[model samples]
Target chain A: MKHCLILGAHSDVALAIAHQLAKEGHSLWLAARRFQDLEPIQKDLEIRYGVPVACFAFDAEKPESHQAFVEALPECPDEVYLVFGYLGPHPGSLEHPTDARRIVQVNFAGAVSVLQALALAMQKRGKGAIAGISSVAGERGRKSNFLYGSAKAGLSAYLDGLRNYGYHHGFHVCTVKPGFIRTAMTAGMDLPKPLTASPEQVAKATISGLRKKKGRVYVLPIWRWIMCLIRNIPDSMFRKKQL
Target chain B: MSPFKQSISNWGNYPLTESLVYQGKERPASGPYIARGMGRCYGDSASQAQIWSSRANRCMLDFDSNTGVLTAEAGLTLDEILQTFVPRAWFLPVTPGTKFVSLGGAFASDIHGKNHHGNGCFSDHVLWIDLENAEGEVLRCSREKNQELFELTAGGMGLTGIILRVALQLHPIETAYIKQRSIRCRNLQETLEQILAHQHWTHSVAWIDCLAPGKAMGRSILLLGEHAKANELPEKYQNQALKPHSTQQKNFPFFLPGFALNSFSVKTFNFLYYHKHLPKQKEQLVHYEPFFYPLDAIGHWNRIYGKRGFTQYQFVLPPDQVDGLIKIIETIRAHGMGSFLTVLKLFGPQKENYLRFPKEGFTLAMDFPLSPKLEGFLSQLDALVLKHGGRVYLTKDLRMPPEMLMASYPQAEQFRQKIKEMDSKATFQSLQSQRLDLHL
Candidate 1:
């Protein structure tokens, strides 16, 4: 069975992905800022699926600890899932420099640091696959949530570059861009039901893309066409309308 | 987080209320709140001015395969537990008609099943529970420890406190299939006789044709079941005896118009149902899903009752009160009220306690669409039930008068006294508790 390491294991989507992987008989390494909170999840997954699961302390805000967290693992994981992203309160988030920086650091900069450490280690081992959760919000910046959207946009572009790098390094990378997901992150938000996908749907799409070695995946097929339409809208028109 | 005002309803879709909804794991800092889970109770038991949902608190805390015990957050649904443990040859000791219910809801209702004749209510299998009282103190209650609190909370209808976590015993099964025997009974007498004759079966229930008239009144089909052993399975299922059900569910997309479930339609549905089993007796191997939760296969099946919704009139009459049970069934027939799903089951003797519903008697549950006349009609039925020393299931009741609750449950006053002692401020309360005068 393949061993998978999941960063931001405390998030709803991350937990869903962990369940999917464990169901498939894969050993899991769950890491999060408050690893103690993951003890129940670890015990549950292990007992339910009869798969070995371990938890580790991780903080996406602290890139300095990313390398040591990777080095401390008893063994390099065959696959790594970067399922963490922070969408701070919108509308006024950009006015607070600290909030804007947190959005960018947690969703993009911290991800790059951890991916770099994992990629280098996997390169030495000569086989590994990585799946990173991006967002359809990144396809086009909306006035409503541009701060969080732009950070995801940067993360998506970085995943593209990493996929190219992995092409030559004999490893693989999959970028998953999901539409509005009904998770704790977006709990009270009044997103349209038809446009929203559940966390389980996102997890399934990500796992399937990784298995097929596809470079990119859209959690909901409709999101791909929806994003394509939005990306084609002229800047003049897009700037005039609130999306 | 601030509580938001929202309109909410239970599975019955009746008595919609505008309430302050708080969604999180932490108990609200103040009083006058009720804990809701999946909102499947069909009445006002889970509704309150301040409703705290335990949906997000779901998590499995621990499990021991060797002992077949599981400890999990109260918010976890039976469906989730089945998905995880059925494959491992373990099953819930007692599950209600639908697996969509939360563990906490099950315990609060002390729900019983067809197997109630042999086993008991869900609380009978629960080992311990951690309850958050009005003062936010978490008390670990079990029969051996905090004994009084444990007994009082078993069927307290979320008034005792918020259930946090529960440790329960699970029964081991040889397979995920049930050996079923279907027996046709011509009338109410025959149905009751068949049920008594099949007392040895682990599970027994009957579907009565409420629309049948006179000599044909209460004509029913009795279904008895036992967990199928591996050797009892056919060759195809022998290899994976404990294979969990993996069937795709069909969703009932939208609410049918209120007029759609009129008497004619119900009569037709009941006619076909009773005649579907042509033979007097038939034996077969059925999957646990179809046997225990036939309605769950059709998601949102409640919508079939229409936008006006419906209420399930469920009550258990004492074993010696067969005449009263007959009079009640005849009255429904006389009124031409076609109850589409009329379920009847025999319950074994239960140790009288706080508010558990099950007892040594005949329990019947029937769904009737709500209308202006429904209130008056159900009130008449309530009088009959109370006269016969029976009580309506609070989980399914919506408009029973407060006097009925006091008249039926002898311990109601004692339960209120205990609640007054435990929650002096009357912090934990629900619409049902308020309507029944459970809160001091």
Candidate 2:
């Protein structure tokens, strides 16, 4: 059985990943913001899959705690998943400095920090996989959600560079760009059913792609086709849209 | 000399190109190796070796216009043959989607074309293959000498060795247009019955509409065809035309940016395609190019997926898994990501190749433009297929789990045993092999 360490395990997507990996016979360490918040999921995963699983608090927002979390692990996980993000307020992001900083720190700065520390550890071990959940909103800057989108955009680019870096370094990095998912984070927004995907859908895609060691993948593959059409709109035509 | 390694990124854009370097022989040094054909195959069945290597390695060995038999170096291309022999009133006995593929590739892929219902695959017409086994001796494989390898290589994707030359059977035709009959089936069952009932026709293919949910799912357009006789042509063209030919061609220079193929565009295209061939169930004379390869008319067609190439998912369901096929389509529709192009074909009888994929079942091929929902859809489909005793086509699969693949292909152990005994050092390999963990 493979061993999996899920960073930012508090997110609905991270829990789903843990559940799926455990079902596939992978032992798990589901790390999150509050160790207590993970107890229910940890119990459910272990009970349903009959696999060993544990939970630990991992505050990705804190840079100093990153190394200690790794040092305390029972063993280096075969795969490390980075799924933390702060969609922070769109209106507040424009006028408030802290909102913007929080969005950047949580999405790009912290995720990268943890990835670097973990990737170095993985490199020395000679094998491991790093998967990060990025957003399709990062495909291009949008007037409505540029702050969250921009952070994700940076993370996506960073993952690409990491992928190239890991090519011969004995490990792999996969960047996941999901279109729009209906999660607690997206609880209040109005989303089109046809366009939005579920957290389970996103989780399944991310782990399956992880197994394949694919360079990068869009969870719902047709999004590749959908994005293809959207990206081709002439600039003059695109500048006037609300989409 | 050393074996060359080159990274291939895109699919079907560059001219059947591959980098080549010679690895010195270990055993008595067999004959020189030649480039295998198009690589459309699933196994390593058609390979052989040549003493000389160069661009001129390809040669037209023989042609009997009367009986329509042609023999050429395995390196010769289907397009080249079509150009040379089509004008002379002869055409390939069988053809897949595009003509740009090589004869060796066709045999390797053991390709089946629009007429598979009426004709079998390329193996049905393949006369012989010039093979050079591991021992470095040239062995002519047919239904005779080295018959097992010949049968294995017919649909084999050149895994055994190199194919030096091929002898093929060509078909005689009076014109380049086909008298086609188009029928719209309300669903898959009707479509299958129609194809079986019309099996006497020379060609048959169906464009299945996989997006429709529930009662409307699996709707399709069935096309039946036969080469047009001279008298069937329009009077204007028939008066001076001893032979008819295609006169239209279009090209797409580069991959359009991603986001160009959204639901709106795909839905519109599907609607137009469905209605254009609808209600009117009759026959008409049409050019063969559009009939055989409407997609090929546009170049770099795969570029439509943009920089991130897409994978074509094809699977076959045994008779018992018929309901499973419906579920697979429904799952995609439920996910709101219907594939742009999906095809369903019924394969009759089974070939002898132990590793052959089409084993007496109905097969469906769909092009899934990459997306997040894709993984979930494929995973669910993979499990359902495994439960129903179905298998995915390895040639078109890029992300199947090794465990699932092992279970799906009962012959996996046999294939492993063969590879272990024949190529223990693992000299022949590919991205697919690595992805599926099909290597030692």
Candidate 3:
């Protein structure tokens, strides 16, 4: 029952965290779209740390499969990570309603559909910790990627409410907001190098936050101050200035 | 999106060129690909267009506890292997000066080490190799199976085929420590004599003072070592004999200033180093990490050679060419191009089936920083070496002309024939392979 379950385990951050956690001697259940895809990661964690690792197939859009994925686990997890995410849009998605909807469906609605069940199971046991990888883009609706940002914003709010719910239910929920990481999702982008955090750094801070039961965490830790400055900006001055 | 393009070079930092480096997580075993490991070679052996980086493919496939035979992906680094296996009383059969190199690179380079006098190159212990030919079909090759392919791929420099995985025979060690003795050789003759006389020693090498003139022409500090048996360890390390090799690795954060590491400073450093051993305190218990890989302790130490980069000229002279070897050393002294690290070692018999760098000979490896006149001087040295039936190590070479390559490798044509048979279209090719016409 003290196992670590990683949903959307194919994400770069999830894989990094899996290495960190498995090194610290935790049994792992990695659930991704294709269990076969996670086979290599599963084998590595199992061999490198001499720990047990299980891989499962679960699509975020296919909500009905979530419960079976959880039940199929060798044991219920005490620590859960919901790292499923998508950053995509059809060309000219700004004007196309379908593309925007798909973005929200994958990021917000899809995550909530699964996390809701996980949060309930943990609430029933009166104990557990769940760390969800949110993003700094959620802090404000950036015009460049607001569709993706809006979904993260909605997910962060849900985490806030869930943390309050877990407060009484004897569980912990951590909202990990990473500013930038060089991951599969962000490859080929000419991102500001100095501001970007590596996947290892994000995993480390998130794990630290989970250990301390911190309600909100920022990767690189500097994003905490940056987001604070952005959040408190007055609408009059903020709207007039480019981010 | 298009592949990531970057100007990457070997660890020497020489001849930097743009490459469409594959940055994906998947291994590029199939399709047109050339396997590029840590790029530790001093030359273009690891550089090519469509460079398939072996970064993501370092999974340990299997390990036979009974025989200590470990099956691992080509991408796995020697450092990673040592970290995992040292505690289990297993060590690599042969490792180059650095642990940063990958298994794939090791197989391709067919590297020899201090133990070459006894064990031979890295491929001697490699039992089988899984190669994806140009047609994208994986073939299991070994000495008993596709014997010729195995031998060709061993020192094939990633030209014959791309290595996907290899099963290596590991040397068992009682402790991660080596019982070592330093024999300080006074000059060129003594250095050769010292290395030659140490046949009883399991591992041996010398650090020569390249600038030392006259009686001190080849003054060197020779090191001979044997893996410490359990009984030989001190009281503190008795129970920890099989513990992992650990060190506090210090790193050079950036390229050192161009003016640093010049002739005078290096000579002074070598002088101080040679005297530090001084016959009195020759014996010591050392962890294999520092003994085998002193440069690895200082990460990115190659950057100290400056942006222009450096070239390493390592040649093996047949036993009868003692006079020729000494002449080569004297010529280097006359040139005054100045060398930084000069190592002298005696190599044993050639054991690999196809292509191998070492035979029964004396090997001299030296590093010289890039200078305008240095290339001309080296070419002259290469000619002298060629006359003596000596050959420069291809892995350490950056600028050997194609003619010199053909003259150096007797098996070059045979290797070419085998490569042509396997990779007719030459899908797997490196900058070095193309330059030397290995795909003929």
lDDT of 1 by residue, B69-150 (tens): 9999898999999988899999999999999999999998899999998998999999999998877788999999988888
lDDT by residue for model 2 (B1-440), tens? 22333322324222222434332232213332333344433222212222122122345656776788887766677766765676677888888777767777677667777776567778889889886555556778998777877876665545555566788999988877789999998887788778788878888878888776567688888888899887778986575333433435567778867698776676677767888885659788877777787776776678787655566778888866778887887877777666678888776666646445666667888776666667877899888788888888765666778898789877665665675576566444444454466566
Better of 2 and 3 by TM-score: 3
Give the total clashing residue pairs for model 3.
Answer: 0
**What's the C-alpha lDDT at position B41 in model 2?**
33
TM-score of each: 0.97, 0.58, 0.94
User: Sorted by DockQ, highest first, which candidate order results?
Assistant: 1, 3, 2
Question: What are the runs in model 3 whose C-alpha is more than 4 Å off?
Answer: A89-92, A95-102, A184-193, A232-243, B23-33, B352-355
* DockQ of each two-chain model: 0.50, 0.01, 0.39
Q: How good is model 1 by TM-score?
A: 0.97
Model 1 DockQ reads 0.50
Q: Can you write out model 2's per-residue Cα lDDT over A1-243, one digit (the tens) per residue?
A: 988898888766886787678768989988888777565566556544568887878887898888888878887789988887888656224687888888888898889888888888888998999999998877767667778888898999999999899888988999998888876556435677777888888898898888898888898887888878877888788878876
Candidate 3, A1-243: lDDT as tens digits? 249988888778988898889879988889888778677677667667778888888888787877776666675579988888877754224787887887788778878888888887888888899999888888887657778888999999989889998999988999999888987556546778867988889889888899899999888767888888988998888877656
The prediction achieving the highest DockQ against the true structure is 1
